[model samples]
Target: MTTATGPDLRERAETVLATLAGPGARLREDQWVAVQALVEGRRRALVVQRTGWGKSAVYFVATALLREAGAGPTVIVSPLLALMRNQIDAAERAGIRAATVNSANTGDWERTYTAVDAGEVDVLLVSPERLNNPDFRDRVLPRLTASAGMLVVDEAHCVSDWGHDFRPDYRRLRQLIAELPAGIPVLATTATANDRVVVDVTEQLGLGRHDSGDTLVLRGSLDRESLRLSAVRLATPAQRLGWLAEHLDALPGAGIVYTLTIAAAEEVAEFLRERGHPVASYTGKTDPAERLAAEGDLLANRVKALVATSALGMGFDKPDLGFVVHLGAPASPVAYYQQIGRAGRAVERAEVVLLPGREDRDIWAYFASLAFPPEPLVRQTLAVLGDEPLSTAAIETRVDLSRTRLEMLLKVLDSDGAARRVKGGWVTTGQEWVYDRERHQRIAEAREVEQQAMLDYIGTTECRMQFLRRQLDDPAPERCGRCDTCTTPAWSTDVDAGTAAAAQERITRPGIEVAPRKQWPSGMAELGVPVSGRIPAAELAAPGRVIGRLSDIGWGTRLRELVDGTDPDDAPVPKDVLDACVRVLAGWGWEERPVGVVGVGSRTRPHQLDHLARRIADIGRLPLLGTLAPTGPRPEEHANSAQRLAAVWSAFEPPAFGMPAGPVLLVDDVVDTGWTATVAARLLRHAGATAVLPFALAQKG
Candidate 1:
């Protein structure tokens, strides 16, 4: 490694080291190398280090080197508040002056602009959201032109859609980098990235013709020696719950139970609590106080386990977690890795269990369907609003949708820039806003068709490590001795026979074929159930009431509408009534039919009403009863897997020194869950990971 022993670089590194080490200080070999590279004015460098690998030490040293070279100021664009706070705290502890500007702290545009323009701060840490603020662009960024020394894009993987965290705003960072003066070095740091992401980062940041070898790509093994990877097949919901309950006693230190939805999260939390397990729940819906308290309890070891919806692991620094359980399949491998990564941070042996079932896959499919809007819809939406801002109401009128649905579609389009919102409402900027619509749509469709592909790989009767190696395109050893898939005998017979049998039985059952149902209203009887009334009719119709009612009764339903035999203009049933019926039917054990159904009572089972009432009573006792509905999946649950993966790609929370390394486990509901996880995991592992293990609750037989 090139070492910077020059007086100038040495003095700078020493100054920074003195502050970092308190009294007497000495530079570590890696820190010294980083400082030397910075002093050499290398325009681009890739620090590929493992968890607890002192990546930040290198950055801190580089910061000091810039300061010593009389470079005006450095800007650090970080993804998360916790990470920014962590950096700021470190600087303060070292007696080095630093400040962070984020949504939480930017009191006013004027003050923020003044601070940046006046050069009141030395090192500035900011979130991407703050970068788009008009004040920041017009005032703050302009001042940086004269004094901008180095720009660091932290968690750089977020810039790529292929990454776990695909933030639209992050894509605009290229413009920011372009605004900086020529010859100003750019440093991009991330814990994970694949070849694609690295190439994309280099091109996006305008770092042309840089030697890829000199990028300092640090390749780390994906083996987690301290983590035991295991999985269990959950033939039924009761079995899954029982397995969780049984394992609760064996877990030591902090633990996390990842579920597919908020409802599942709450259910698992309550079930554990009822079984005398000290547990808490965390989801996007969790209030700030609840979230903080739950996080604090987990960190302080006051709570043994936290049942969460992929929201508990980001920016969390707990290193001694004993176990992380997937109550259902995580949406993707990326999600699985991030959740599992939360455990064994303190170096002790930790365990991860993936409870697989068909229900998990169904949940994943449902969410994946929403991730990318249909191509026709995107095309039509753009066509209708050619560069004119219209009120949300007007857009709804044009699209023939409820305000809620219109808003969601608009938001998705806005993110892609196929549409933008002005004061009045939303408008399509142009066709350029539609980003690879065909590719995006294909990815979405692949999620449906290839649901079994990942599950087959995960549950393969072949070498598990080999399977992972193939999936990740890893060029190292052909076999990884670890992994349940590697050790478990590959079963020639259908791996998910039970789930397949159940779905097949439902599909082949003799039943009356009804026309496809449009949106509808809830009936009084169906609405009588407390948790059943909260869901809208649209959800009930798409999945159908039979599946919804079955879900209410605790039976898993994986229903998808077969697009045929339906009048597009048919008057939809009342939303409330439809939701209630779905809830009621789900409780009755009505097998979800393959084709869509308009009327109720297509295939009713016995005692469904009783089960629905009991489920409502069961849900009523839970703390999240009012906060999250019992009948349908929470909105947050739909995005749980994606969010977790995004957190890994976007949120960079450095491990504390002396902490043990842990393997990242991506949990999802089903391997067929979505491409989100596959894409996410590929990116994370490519970004210099030690290992990425994926766990699913269930797979399609």
Candidate 2:
């Protein structure tokens, strides 16, 4: 009930709001409250509102008012590159100078820092990842923190470990907030936080203060009248794709088509394009320029949809996005809500649908394995990371971690004070690091609960929008009357027989090439393995074949079932799979057909490999050079390249033919890291085969 107290404050804020939002636009009641809290009271505030509810307007107006009072720049700790781009543009519209310092614009950092020092930048947007940059942390951040007038955490839900989109980089915000000057206004905003996430983030924001009672929290009901939510439980992946191809254009306006995996996104986009839909694929692996173009196409309404993964979520502002369709349900209702928030922002109605698939949980389990590495792995990483800094490439040789997993682990450790990234690369801090198993276990449990809730959402006949609102700890007194459950169903239940058959054929006709390892893994010297440098061309295996990616929907599903079996009865390859291998060979068109077949004897799937090799040799009339016997049990399937290489090196002994050298076909159950194939191929070549062509039933992409 305290008065805002300054007549000029309200007048200037009105004018700034007019410029930021359109000329006739005015702040909502909660928006004005947030601006007043930051500018006049200099109080900490958290705003949890639905998307397009003017959260950005609150900060832009605060920045304008604060700058008018001669304050330093408002530092916004944003999450994604797309979020940063939207923020920079919003800042400009409010007549505030904004500059971003992120990984994308490295060359502009000097100029950006100079502008900040000179007090020419009014609002500075920075990615959370930048907070971990050694140069930014040691040099630039101190000055920015000491002089910053306000700190705005956009997408603040990510600050909480309990959030659906938890990021280690966002955790560094706790230390940053503690370092800020007392009474400097701080604001946190997110559209997709439940009660738990909100509490965690509020506590994080109040770390420096003894009491959080004064921290203003404005929690609004999560109800979007503009969205007409619905779900269609498709039995097969092909049926879902076929439904999308036939019905995508019928959805109101240009929006997004979300898929669970990058492979799915690419496949969906390709199928849509072949069916004559103008769609582009967007994923984390997309090139930077291509991402911009894809975003622009969707924004311009030039394409029907951007087939994308979670990369397209968070702070992508398009006022009139018309629809959102999911090929597969996201792992959590919170995340699904955030993605569907992209639609119907400015329109009276936007269509939203989910086509849940059976294979989604398998994908989720694969992702779950990437959680914070085990304690042993972490300790091993620290032991190799000495006082002297070692580049990631150098560390990769000594560590058995892949590039992505290693970098993610390094960031978490860096934020936790157990590791530091200096000028050269990464170094251990010699600090004690606890595993905190109970906490991660709780998180895992919560994830499982969310996933079950998602399944319930697909099965529930109750109000779809209301169920989502309840998942976010918001109540809806009555059902949303627009969803499929609330109203009569509007779409057809089945895809045409022809279309479904063609879609299934397209997905089932699989022959994915497994590229051979050309260069040896780095840092092998550190692991007591002397081998390094490029793999010799003669010794390396030729590009081989797999029926499909284990992440793919068609043959991949069967492959996963085959490899993940608990019983010994499933060892031998099935006839359909064997016939599929023949189809692969018939279509592969190698420079020369294999003169002989050699099975990489498996300790696990021995019958499958032997049967596949024997059948291929029998059909091709090629010599059966017999098996590559193992000295011991094969390496752990989940082990990284270097570890697998160490286990498989000198482990395989191919039978000597004592005949003229010729190309040999090496068969295995799966191709994951390719190190096993590399080692086995080397042995086969040394045993007198001119070349080795590796083949597997599946590729774990």
Candidate 3:
């Protein structure tokens, strides 16, 4: 092995880069500075560069050089599985061996561990969540920390709450770094960190106050030469969709279509395919297999576009991805920059556009609600675990958090040492946990500020690239002459009348199936509800329909306004909504038309439910069977399925007019959770109805 120095390492880095990026490739000045800091100086470094600036090359080259000097394999903590896979492939091209351990490939963990322990791997990539897992944290991490040659934090912005995409799991990396031996030479890299996020990441990388001075911070101008940024403010979502349907294929090359919600992604993908464009929908809800397949299709240019959520946000590596168009604006400029970073990395030019929507804020608020749980709920969760451990399902019966929310809370708790997740379930550690109200409030306020910044970005007449760079506190930000403001707005600003009309018709058409629950939530017995396992088929409510989901783009807009109104003077039911409901019934194709109509009495919007049922029964000429009465005070909205089910079990009384001889239709304002429908149907069946069907103005999908 040769002595490591800046001059020596730069030559070696050139050889590696030549192999990775053709024989003529040479290291950029900043890329060499990052490599030198990690290898020769043996100091922690934070490299904040725009996407496709060869940040990964710095780490891969450093790891190869350090390993040649007999150092242990580099351990990379990546944020997404896509990143890890991409890194592994990139590593192989440079003649360096790499392996990844993520949730998607647990079966390969043991084999990978064997190889890492035996020195067959040059780089090991693992997710942030893997750090808090007891098996890995207690077993593998300790060994890796002791012998690791270099540590890399990919998408390091996630370690900071100020980042647009913060994950609680990423915070545990502080502990991982704390446990590592001093001067192990760590590298943290991200393309989207603003000033606050950069400060947070630097502090984490410093490890301790004494080492803070030694940490190297390299922040490059965020302007991407290949990107031509533009924003189009459309009046309606349909026109936006129309524009995409008309011009998506005309974009430079294969690229990504980003949506704020999964439903929108699917809807846009379907519309594009209908327009004869090759596209696929990829969201967090997509199966891991399908996501991987979609990724492959995009990488190979087999599909012209992938309609995706932030699930495809960071760490995806496609050298020449030509465009990124947002169906709806992301809540923050930081987030928008990160998503759009997926495009134009290696290409000479890639088009970037934002179609700001009216519904973006609602989506923002829905996610904002998922922050750290309140102190009382956290305490109640702690109290639920006694000497015996309980699975998440058992805890859900006692607590009122959604599975996703609860799991996130549990991870926070685990990080705080208040809980320990074992093989069977979780057990309380009896640790004291402080509820950081001030911190949470600050985070929320920061989100608002960022959201406002995003709005500013969309409406700004100044240079788009310079605006983004200024947000990140770039040292010398300036206008790039390629954006719409700097250059002419070359894109079309109109949706043809015929196309807009067709889109309006398609969007206005509504009917979403409100599928009834087939099985009872687990641990119902503990909640004093005797039911468990699958609901008997005879008692199960038949599949039902709703006018639309409140989260959708079309009727969702109208439904949100109507349902959000709490005024007693609000109209009973708007004529347009009534017509839509009638259309639903007209096209229902029900196995049996409802024999009678029954309203599910509501504490709020009673008039909405009653009027809808009465109008439906009158139109169909069926008898009104009266409303189901509340047995007692309705419990405040339950948080999770189990809690909601337990509350609704005894909340409804059978209809006073008794069940009709045939199936009865149950009407409510909204069918969120569907537990209300399930319990009400069982009540109607017990009251001697042959069958029950549920109808709602909107669903909370």
Candidate 4:
């Protein structure tokens, strides 16, 4: 193998680019600069260029040159499986052997490691989470880090907590970079980071804070000439769906329709399918196999669009994707730019639209609530920590945090050196950890500022592309004489009344199954709940129904209003909500009909529950069984499953009438954790009820 000198580096790079992209493909000036910096200068560089700028070309060309020069394999810390797969294909096209070690390919790790050990592999792709993996970090990483030719951090914006899509796992890369030998070229690339995020990521990519001055920062104009940006304000979800039904096919080729929540993704996908559009739902909850199949379908143009959430947001590259539509605006323009970047990469033109919704803020609030908890909660978590390792579930029992929040906190603590994750679980290091209240507050405030900026973008009469670029602090901002405001509207805002009516009917038709909990949450005994394993069949509530999830686009809108605490606590159920409840009961395909109705006693919203139960009893011509009385005040909000069950275990007393003769309907206004219903149903069974059929107006998914 002949290593090209600095004089011929550009010539060699263009040759590799031609093979990787196409016969006539050539390197852009900035691309050549990045490649030279890595291959010749062996310097750290941060590239903040828009999509389709051929950032991969720079890295792959550098890898090719470095390998011929007898350097070790390039290690790329990519964020997603989709991105890794794409990079591998690109590497193979350039005749560079690339292998990935991610959760999806555990079975192939041994083979991959062996190939890396040999000189057979030129590049190794790894997910950021791999850096924190116990076995991989301890055994495989040291060898790779010590001998790595170049290090690449793709989607590098994730390293900054101030960034829109920050992940704690990505922060582990700082240590990895710190340990890398000097003169090992490092490249961090992202398309969506702002000025603040760029500085943060550059500092981390450098060897140390003072040495960050040496890192080359190349930022290009954040402009997509192929995208026609537009925002349509729809008064209702029905109108939005109606617009999609009418206009989805008129857009260029196939593309993605992004939603804010998993439920919304499923809901929109189902609606679009019913409207005769071939679409599939892709979300975090989607099975891994199904996700792969869906991705394949989109790539092959088998589906018109994929209704997805942020799970499909980053690193999904579909060149020539015709359009990118958002059912609800992302809270940050930076995040929105990253998602829509998937489109217009290889096409002459593509459509980018945002159908801003009133519920977007509420959805944003829900996600923000899961951010780092209050200081007292953190202290409570630390107080329970000992030298002995405690699993997340066990820690959850001691703290009043949800599983997601608890796991995130533990990861943060581990990164801060206050906690260590070993084979068993997490153990405290007894290192004094101060809560960075100012930093957290700044992050929270920045979120609010970004959210307001997004709203402003939707309502702005200025050029949409210009507004987005300015939000990202693009050095050069220019009005693209495209977009709805910059020029005449390319898309009609009119929603066909009949189509909207049909959409309303589809969305309004609601009944979501509430699967009963079978197994008791682990470590329940630690919370003073003796039960463990599966709950006995005698005490288990039958699979029930909720009118809708709080995150739903249709019935969820009304349900959210009913239980969002804005309404009077003593208010009765609305007439329309009652009608929806009746509709749900009419369609329930239960083998055994309920002979009576019993309401779960509520200190808050008692009138609502009582009125709903009595009305259902009257309509069904069944006896209204007595309501269970609350034995305590409402349990603390956001309690994990075990703590929630413990608090609600003795919180409800059996009805004064003792028990109903047959299967009884257990009613509540809303079910958050489902523990209240679980405990109440068990109490009714203990009181000699034949069965308990639980139901709720809305469920918080």
In terms of TM-score, which candidate is strongest? Answer: 4
* Residue-by-residue lDDT tens digits, candidate 4, 1-701: 34566658788888888889999988889999899888888888889998878889989999998998899999999999888888999999999999999998899999999999997899999998887787898899999999899999998988888898777888778778888987799999988888888878876554444235678888998898899999999899999989998899998999999999998899889988988999999999999899989999999999999999989966677888999999999999999999998899889899999999998998999888888889999999989989898888889888989887888788788777788778778888999999999989999999999999999999999988888888899844467898899899888889999999989998898788898888899998877888998999999988889999999988877888888777765788888988999999989988889988898888878887899999999988989978898987786665688888888887876668856567999988888888888888888888887888898999997
| Candidate 3 ranges beyond 4 A from true positions | 1-3, 204-206, 209-211, 385-387, 475-477, 660-662
How many residue pairs clash in each candidate at the backbone level? 53, 2, 0, 0
lDDT of 2: 0.85
Q: In order, what is each prediction's RMSD in angstroms?
A: 16.6, 2.5, 2.2, 1.7
Candidate 1 C-alpha lDDT tens digits along 63-168: 6666656665678888876677668876665555577778777565466556656766567787877655545655576776557777788777677655556555
Pairs that collide, model 2: 397-522, 397-523
- Minimal lDDT window, size 10, model 1: 594-603
Error of 3 at 491 (Å): 2.3
Q: After superposition, how far is residue 139 of candidate 1 from its true place, in Å?
A: 4.3
Report every candidate's CA lDDT. Answer: 0.53, 0.85, 0.85, 0.88
**Candidate 4 Cα deviation (angstroms), residue 405:** 1.5
Q: Which runs of model 2 end up more than 4 angstroms from their true locations? A: 1-7, 205-211, 379-386, 390-403, 565-567, 658-662, 687-690
